[model samples]
Target: MNSLLPVPPRRHWSTWALLAGLLLLVITSFATLPLKWGDFFSADAVRTTADFLHGFAPPELSPNFLLKVGTATFETLAMSAIGTIIAAVFGALLALPASGRFGKAARQATRGVLNVLRSIPELVWASILLIAAGLGPFAGTLALALHTVGVLGRLFADAFENCPPLPAASLRINGAGPAATFLYATLPQCSPQMLSYTLYRWENNIRAAAILGVVGAGGLGQMLKYHLSLFQMQPAATVIIAMLLMVAAVDGLSYVLRRAMTR
Candidate 1:
């Protein structure tokens, strides 16, 4: 009875199950990898990479190239902004049903739609839209909006669902209609979180828009692709730098806005 003993901590069954699943998935993924280790670090690969780097030694700094880059930068910005705005509107509309405000059947249907929309990558959507809309930023904007609506809709719905129901319930108890309760109580509680997600999506869309351009959706990506195709690495380097700057600027703006919202 006086002997010292160590006690084992308790663990939930689900926790063990999750760990098993993760281990299995990792094992499967490793097995599936098509690695050719012998060729990976070969001398030819190293020399080819060095040759490419040599071509990028000096980026084109001429006034004409800078002006072209500046114009494409604005176009990219416009496409992302417009796309995010449209997605926010559509996402908000779908979020209500997705959050179960309209009963189970409607909720399931709306959620299914959102899942489908988000499951298809934006690049795929852009390629499909490109055929219908032709080569331009318009197709890219549509692609961004579609995929973002699905993402923001799911996010907004989750934010709404996670909010404490007390305030909305109180409003309802006082004879407030569903719409009024949502407007005066639920929306106010969730708007900041929704806005934060929207801003984050906008940042991602900026990068997506650039890539979409390579598919003929029209932006700095198109210019970069053109130069790279011709082996004009100097101008391609300039375009790459411009892309980095644009991404950094959007990231900074998103950070400031998110901080302001939290404050």
Candidate 2:
């Protein structure tokens, strides 16, 4: 028999089921959303949006504002660096246990902890820290660090795990302890992936820092909010331009750094 008896479709495993569930949630959410798609094309909506955009005029010369922008930009850089460094250090520290190269029991415990940590969003963490730290870059930095730790730690552990065990295991067999083998073998293999993810996160943090002002963290986003409230489109445009430039610069630098490391 040629088995025309209807072949089974793919089995819905945990991953596929999760994806399907998410799709259903999105479908249900769209049904409840207040927005109408037609509004984007509506005359009034277009006119209003155009008028708001127009308010952001001649972003050419604003020396005082530029200086302020410069300071805010620096603050953003500082925040991203501090947060990322803290997260990277701590994440690396914790990721080892999850690598399963150490022991089965430790790997399970570490993975469970990492799962809990990675489950929460950075914004939620930021909001909570904002409460405890009372409104500043400190709160934003802490928020980003805490969240980054979870993300990068899990990623690091995975990268470590995915590497060929031969090199590390050989070192261990030759009397290398877990730490020694990691330094010589596992860390090097994961280095490229780690750097790439870290750089990506750093870029994201720049964008996140810009908007953390909604929680009173204070950055160019705060300035943008102020300008929008007062209907100062020109200055707002200037801030947006500056952010674009900053992000572009970060992207370029990261590309160079990654190439250098890989080479």
Report the lDDT of model 2 for residue 154: 91
- Give the alpha carbon lDDT tens digit for every residue of 1-263 in model 2: 66968887776598788999999999999989987889889999999988877767778466888998888888877888888899898888888888776699999998888777668776787788888898778988887888788888899989988998899989989999877888999888899999988987888878887777666776776777777778777888888888888888987898888788888
Q: What TM-score does structure 1 among the candidates reach? A: 0.92
TM per candidate:
0.92, 0.84
Tell how far residue 250 is off in model 1, in angstroms.
0.8
Against the reference, the lDDT scores of all candidates come to 0.94, 0.83
The true-versus-predicted C-alpha distance at residue 196 of model 1, in Å, is: 0.5
Clashing pairs in 1: none
True-vs-predicted CA distance for residue 200, candidate 2, Å: 1.5
Candidate with the greatest TM-score versus the true structure = 1
> What is the C-alpha local distance difference test score of candidate 2?
0.83
Clashing residue pairs in all predictions, respectively, total: 0, 4
